[model samples]
Target: MTSTVSSDLRERAEAVLATLAGPGARLREDQWTAIHALVAERRRALVVQRTGWGKSAVYFVATALLRADGAGPTVIVSPLLALMRNQIDAAARAGIHAATVNSANTGDWERTYAAVASGEVDVLLVSPERLNNPDFRDRVLPQLTATAGMLVVDEAHCVSDWGHDFRPDYRRLRTLISELPAGIPVLATTATANDRVVVDVTEQLGLASGEPLVLRGSLDRESLRLSVVRLATPAQRLGWLADHLDALPGAGIIYTLTIAAAEEVADFLRERGHPVASYTGKTDPQERLAAEADLLDNRVKALVATSALGMGFDKPDLGFVVHLGAPASPVAYYQQIGRAGRAVERAEVVLLPGREDRDIWAYFASLAFPPEPLVRQTLAVLGDDAMSTAAVETRVDLSRTRLEMLLKVLDSDGAVRRVKGGWVATGEEWVYDRERHQRIAEARRAEQQAMLDYIDTTGCRMQFLRRQLDDPASERCGRCDTCTTPAWSTDVDQDAAAAAQERINRPGVEVAPRKQWPSGMAELGVGASGRIPATELAEPGRVIGRLSDIGWGTRLRELVDGDDAPVPGDVLDACVRVLAGWGWEQRPVGVVGIGSRTRPHQLDHLARRIAEIGRLPLLGTLTPAGPRPEAHANSPQRLAALWSAFEPPAFPVPNAPVLLVDDVIDSGWTATVAARLLRRAGASAVLPFALAQRG
Candidate 1:
């Protein structure tokens, strides 16, 4: 039933495959089917296959054939920089030219854009964020969408709000899809979408003429041996990893839920003489690339990482994946584990679930979209002007991250638009989908409960995951710990446990000073912008621990969230240790406490104890000049509230640096404003110190 053109296209696709996957390479039936749907029938298709299933091959081969037929360059919307690099290399192997535009390649964007315009580039890879960028959406995207031969959405599940890793930036793809010329074949792909996500994405990828061709294969990977090792405490978990990490077959990833955990575990392992690297959102782009290369070449035993290393990274021989804490959703967990057991005969996948996992999940859940009233308030703030995100933050009560996400959703809904300067109202009627958001929130809670169930389940681990993914052919794998005998030892040496406890118990994290004044301060009636004057800025400060740390975090959280109480003896001792190890250029000559509206007694006690320990004079306190504002205001509003709230004493302090004590530091705005007041009050220098730092 195939046409002559279809047969010729398949032949050319096979030739491209040989170039990409070596002479022994032949397209899998599904791969050819996907390619034919894209090239021969010009139909939109959604391919949901497991990792190492030749999904990338289908796109590359189809791109080669389409370009040979004089079609414009294929455009791939990738999710990560690492994925773009891998795809570029894969394209070159198939004799297809490719270029990328992302945050890392700003300097070369113009050159790359010119190359694509001149038909020298056969494909263009871009991050989902680029779809919403002002210049790209207005200038470059129209041209690209007009002429693009094939449009590929890699990690397409992100386009669905119900997906585990939903990103507002990915929703902008809807606008791009709607703008693409008719008959320009579209392909969407993901490795970890459940039935719900699959249905959502299929609906989102609706074609102009007909429904998309959906090809979802089985989610099972026979090579992965799954197991869960539940330890009593965080230290035991760390000890278990130290005891057994090397025994796991080959170089792999140790996943953590937070950046603090990643750094903590990586440092612990390195101290024990393991050649490991930490990869997280805070890591430098160039450093991430080097770490990936090191893992690829087997130069490092493992890369301790956060979810930042998820999605697009590829390593065919990855031998294992160990989780320091369970992700909130089984779908996300499956995706992380998929990075292992790709090309190898077998790979070990272990989960070390923590008691703190649900708390972390709840914290993230709090950032979901606010009610309709808050959304309307934001829309009302941007009447006619294009205000920067920070400017919008000043007017809204939401955190910076949540506010930006809401704006992106609004933009996608046509209620607003992102222009070169900032964001502007589109003057279009927008209906807030309250029911949809509620459904999503409920779904997220269910997913969290499912993750907890997964940890406690005594049944087959792979089968539980398959059921969570709603796989129709879900079955128990005989390779798991439950199906077979336990494959991993859960013993933790006493010395290793002691070492982990000691390392975690050691406190004091440097709190970097705010260097720049937040933007649009003028609008908030504050006269500051750009860099903070060096004289007014607080010197680098210190916190006993982060609110997310494994050791001091729990204690700090209890102190901050519990009823008013004096600083505990252990925390005070830790503070003393922090002071002893401060290594400050100039020692504090006196202590001053910032007045706390809620925890005045706690701050007062902390300041008095520090003064007693150092044998220094207790300077007068900084009193609150006015009533407190809302607790969850954005940076600029917080700055505005604190600008004139602190009343410093008129008398000058001793001729040495002053330690400004507080119960907790959240925005650093209060500390900045307090330091400025003390500096103006004739203190030699101000050093802000806190018991805890909230991220």
Candidate 2:
């Protein structure tokens, strides 16, 4: 690293930046330091800088400089599709050819692969998941690693289990790092890693020799004026947003904890005459892109979104970020609000802390890796043959998300490998680190408590966040709400509150009938396979509300938790309203109750009430032919447990559509089995209805 060489690399980096960020663009001191380490010294570096700190520029410029010196393409492992898209567009501006391989562009993969193979791509952006893709890992990844001039891990905090947003897919990068040629520069960048996360990520990216260069900047954002507005209820939060969304500066994002909440908020705001769109994990990719475009172009007031819209969305001039409910971790909150005020002088950051945040956090925490016995059972089942995730689910008791997460952890740990069709046990001995898992779980609980403290803290909000991130330089900022008089109004209009209440209170989500039987049912002695016959299938059903929903969720939880208490008057009335508004093709002519082992009286009362309201006959109950099985079994097991448990009514069933009443719908297997029996016993059609649907 001579003076002449250093000067030349600096000049080249500046030129790349000028192309990327206009003619007057210049790299900051830390950015230059990172570029110098990567290009001039060929050293590994971890940069923990704030958002909009030109992190992309450091890597893009290094890519340009390295490519000019006859090195291979720079390979970047990113965590998000939106980030990859943004990076590709940014690279093109800097005169660097960038292409991405992600789930959204499966058709273009071959063409992109060909371009990369021919050396037409200067920078290749790929998702961490792609690193574990059977085809990519077996083919492209090897070439990319062997010839890569520089490796960049964007959103590197995700590589650390301690990070707020940890994904097991990111752990696969360790294998990639180990396979890379010696002295090829590596850069890991993130805006959210705290001290623990930074330490963990650095260890994951450690070189065989000397320490990696770690660059950390201040975490404070002067442009963001943070505040918390405690809303007593979900409806009040929605009302506040509807009343004040237009008053916020320019266009922004309104984040919700759940997809249902996001949709509910967006719908409520739209009904109140705001031009808002919903963005969540369930939103179509094309629609998500459109919503992003709308927000960027200021076409919409805001996008009511979940964490699906959180990372890698680079809107420099984003005017505000309003959280309908606080995130479980302060680190996550900082990361989200970092999206705002990036290129502006001021931005509003508000949190509407709700009572349900802890409950939501607990639900997510339950998805962590199961005990050692379960893990060993899963591996023993895999044994030698590769099994698809769906096949594994039949033999395992975990939910789909939990099962996938466990498999990914196993794959990253080398105990299992994900191949073309499915995952297979590699017969590699794996030590279950019970202590480590417990520690992580405890850390998560601590983070949740920190979030609660954040909402209640009267000190400067920015300082509180900085301290949470382990920044020692955290000082009271005069820009936040506590440091100054409240800058925003807290008043919500009565009409808006009433409107929001009306929308949320209106329940009845369509319960889609299961089309296909669960795989591997034969192992359980069940002969069911392929698509369920149309005649035997239950018609599209209705539930008063999802257990995760805002309005009826609390009431439904109480009813389900109570000791077989009769349905409350208000809840019963709500069910009647759901029925009145249900737009089914045919009205149910009779009501049949599913004999509940736990809440038989409640189920009977619901059936009687529905019969009275619809003027339908009260068909006799379906009695259990055998003992009740375990309640929390997986779909196949549940179905097997209930297969012949329900006996057809003793009397003749009406030859008309029947309303099958139940207290709660957990797996929907109970409803499916009961409906099939009813349809077989001379009922024309069975429309399953439940007081609530468990998510």
Candidate 3:
């Protein structure tokens, strides 16, 4: 407790809260506990909790308690528009007129200024940038000059440069808060914050001497099962994916790195007839809202998208998440996958890593850095005169978009000031000299390298993450793939090939050819000896045909010896047909194997009939090298589901409506392809479902 509040001040605060909230407004236990502590002790605390942990409630309750004890209206600075809107809506519902000064729904500047000055507003939510404005300082400082109530900084992690979503304006927050009268409390909240962030928050806000309260909620999500799969090639990966879908039948997410990749993958899956949604930055807000509703209503089963779609998303029961490629950094990876398993049920995270994933971030980093000379020139165009960010963009030689980005980086590095007309150079002059340009390039290079190292690290990824934030050295997380899975090879080799063969040859050999399954169905391929004729062999199904297609040209002796041979690459293509005869005497696919069942059941035959009519492939692989999870899921399921899941609802089809679903949708291409596929499948209408729509 560092309170300088006198008895009279405390009483005034109490009176204010009483006048606002009624006696019936009871706070919850956790809220009351934190509020009581903050009010009685006058302590500045950092609340670190997970989503739905009642962080906002605790602060609001504290505000009430302070008013009950004698404090003015609490001031809140928030970063998110949605968060602000939600809070405002809730406040209005509770009859607590909380006004926000965000980009949306502007209020009369004079009236807002007077309200804060007169202490008429209870809680004010504004962006951090607004606080740094000279206009706001002149207008709002007077009312807050008296040891008024409290100031809250939501999403405090944005202040740290190392944070995922660092904001340059957040750096000036401390200076702005310092302008407030001494003894006023400052509180900050974040759903995700580690220890270093806590320290950074307190120190940066000049609250080092203030009582620091740090708390962390549980990170364990028991419902999500974590797993990773290594892919030798893109085609194999697609096959594995088809199988994965068959096993896990429900609404899920598939994350990708680029807009093109998202679109491609989603389109590929959609062609197979899966009901998916594609989302990305390109999606309209109305379309995004519609997608959200579709997911909630179970209209789409999978969403293929980029990382843009999951922030602050409250979908608690996602079936699982699949990473199409490894993320650039652990922070990004963790946060993206964290969206799943929220329901604490049985869920899984699958990573299909490729060498190309290692290079994606570097490409992004190069674009992010631009040329230092270009950046300096752009800043020079803004001149020493204050100007708005947009105005500076207009004057710069670079594209308007690149100029804006360069401006943000420069602003963050403290090279320029963002003003009303355009950005203006601040502090010492910026030099686009050779050395400075080299240095800027070096820093950008280092940032990218660091991100790459995080991706390919051999040690505990979590420990590496901790180090990134300057956290105390921690032990390795024993559960990661590096610790759990055996290293296969720097490159694919003979031993892996032998193992794949063994997996294929394991007793009770069963070949689920592509011809036996529905189109777009997923399945795991077995690495077995080639059997069917050479011409028809390269196709997806016709069990023996697939085996021969993948094994063609390789001598029988090599296969028998389990020696590695070049995989018949063409056979794994998205299309190819089975051309062999001889349906094995195994039980039908998708039948529950209870104990010693060894023959195909009636249901399997029915599924095969449907595949024939639909011209779809079989559910599992014929080649016996190794089997991925998809083999099981794609090969078997309730027969009725296969057709109905992809079938558009009966009745009057929409007028020229297009439906597209993807694991990731960054651009409209994948969605468009999905829509086309839907139309081809007799869908009279098309809509899109994207797991994440980036911006």
Candidate 4:
């Protein structure tokens, strides 16, 4: 009964899909509809479906149909290297030649470009950052624009400011879309877009084609069983994981909010005889690949990870997802947990909500859009000539990461242009969108509140998450712990609790010293720059523990971030143990205290106790010469403020190693300056020791 044209289109599409799913495989009705809209109507579309809905298949199938109809190759702007890898592999299943150009494959770009020009590539994948790459934008982008048949924006929710994982680089896609020729099919797809995100992305990417195909489906998943274990302390959480991780259904992910937490948890679990790996932004690229493969093959229990492992990781039967600490928002939580329960009958999802979650959220919130004055200062620093990021950092007070992010935003807004060597002004008048930025910030706060509400809710957990995404059809999921019998244990055994507490109570964190001076020190009136002289550098230092470590972290945070107090007896005892275990090349001959303004009692207690216990002479303390260094500054600015701020000890210097002590080591620059002074004053070596380090 199918019309001839429609029947022929389906025939061709089914043939192409057969390669991916094998013989007798078929596309869902929605997938077929999306492909039809792109291939037959040549119209733009926004497909907001859940993860594991085969969104990639739509673009791959559309590309096959379009290419056979003599259209130019398709271009896909994907967000992650893992996503691009999966896409290329998927494309090959359908017999389409796929190539990618991203930060990882820079060495093969020339060859890939030649292949694209020679019509040997059917689909090309690229990261959003590459859209603004000077060479790619100047040399190859124009050619692709003129000949491109279709454009695919994967993880399309990132295009909207309302998205939980909003990225500044994704904003550059606006310029890319503006340059594409008319009637070229554009498909923007994501599994995480909420109502606001969908509308925002629709306006940006599909509105030009007049109300392009908008296909949104339900966000609820039937296969996920959600629950939360309200642990009151870090030890209890670690204890519970150690006792119950092996009982989880299959290889899955354990998400943490910070890199330190990820590494800490991974180490703890491994020591408990669970095979696991830590995956975070700090993990090397090749190691990340290996970890992903191990997880895919179920070679390990889980990959303890931060959000770096989120999105586009295709493990169809991933059996579980456990969060050590709650993410700041329910939307982000949902996106992460969505990786599980995709192709399985049921998957376990657990949240071990901790007291430290909100503190972490506030820390990130403090880094929102800078004030108007800073924005103007940044703009004023740019002109016709390209200035390298390092040069810009010399003038701006922002950190290296913040500066790079600001430049990307400016480039997306047309206020600056990235060229060879660096960035230059575009002569376009830029207005600070304070109102919009404020709204986005407020939205973030609301989402964070929603996360708290989700944890406290007595209703269906999956339904609560779906409602946050504005899913109109969100209904009480019958499989959650709140709705059904619990599947995961909530108890922590005595031995497990003791073991976790024991490990955390043991503290010895090596504090790595700053070996090189920051650039542009002259601008800050500090003459020193480049590498610090080895003779003046402090030997690798030691801290009792990091403020982010498991056991001592919370207490250290209270001592440093709160009002001053004398060092606790137990903490001092732990410090003694740290000294006992410190494998120093040369023992200390004397002790010197770096004068403290806020925590004098604590600082002096630590230094005096170390000196008395070690039976060493207490050299004179270095007194403050000027004002306290500014807080929350770049390396150069921090160095500028600290340089010469500490007066050299007035007492005669002994030409031997001395233990330099401080209450808290936040930037490490203070210690560097202190060490350089001690060495210049004729000391043989300086070894820095601190109560805690602020990450």
Number of the candidate with higher lDDT, 2 or 3: 2
Q: Report residue 616 deviation for candidate 1 (angstroms).
A: 1.6
Candidate 3 segments whose C-alpha is farther than 4 A from its true place: 1-37, 50-54, 67-74, 85-101, 104-123, 128-148, 191-199, 209-211, 216-220, 246-252, 296-299, 367-402, 405-416, 425-695
- Which regions of candidate 2 fall more than 4 Å away from where they truly are? 207-209
Give the worst 10-residue stretch by lDDT in candidate 3. 590-599
The 10 consecutive residues of candidate 4 with the worst lDDT sum are 202-211
lDDT of 1 at 621: 90
lDDT of the structure predicted as candidate 1: 0.89
Candidate 3 lDDT over residue span 574-605, tens digit each: 11222222232321222110010121232233
Query: TM-score, each model?
Result: 0.98, 0.98, 0.55, 0.97
> For model 1, how does the per-residue alpha-carbon lDDT over 457-501 read when each residue is reduced to its tens digit?
888888888888877654678999888998987789898888888
Candidate 2 lDDT over 1-695, as tens digits, reads 58898788788889889999999988999999999999888999999989998899999999999999889999999988889889999999999999988898899999998998889999989988888999999988888889899999999999888898889999998888888888899999999988889888977766424678889999888899998887788788888888888889999999999998888788888999999999999999999999999999999999999999988998999999999888989999999999999989999999998787777888888877789998998888896778998888778877777788889999999999999889999999999999989999999999988998888899988989988888865468999989999877777899999988888788888888777888888977888988988888898889899888877787788788887777878888888888888887888877888887878888888888888877888977989887887664468777777788887778788788889998888888888888888888877888999988987
Compare candidates 2 and 3 on TM-score and give the better one.
2
Q: Against the unseen true structure, what C-alpha lDDT does each candidate score?
A: 0.89, 0.88, 0.52, 0.88
What is residue 501's positional error in candidate 4, in angstroms?
0.8
Clashes of each: 0, 0, 81, 0
In angstroms, give how far residue 280 of model 3 lies from its true place: 2.4
**Clashes (candidate 2):** 0
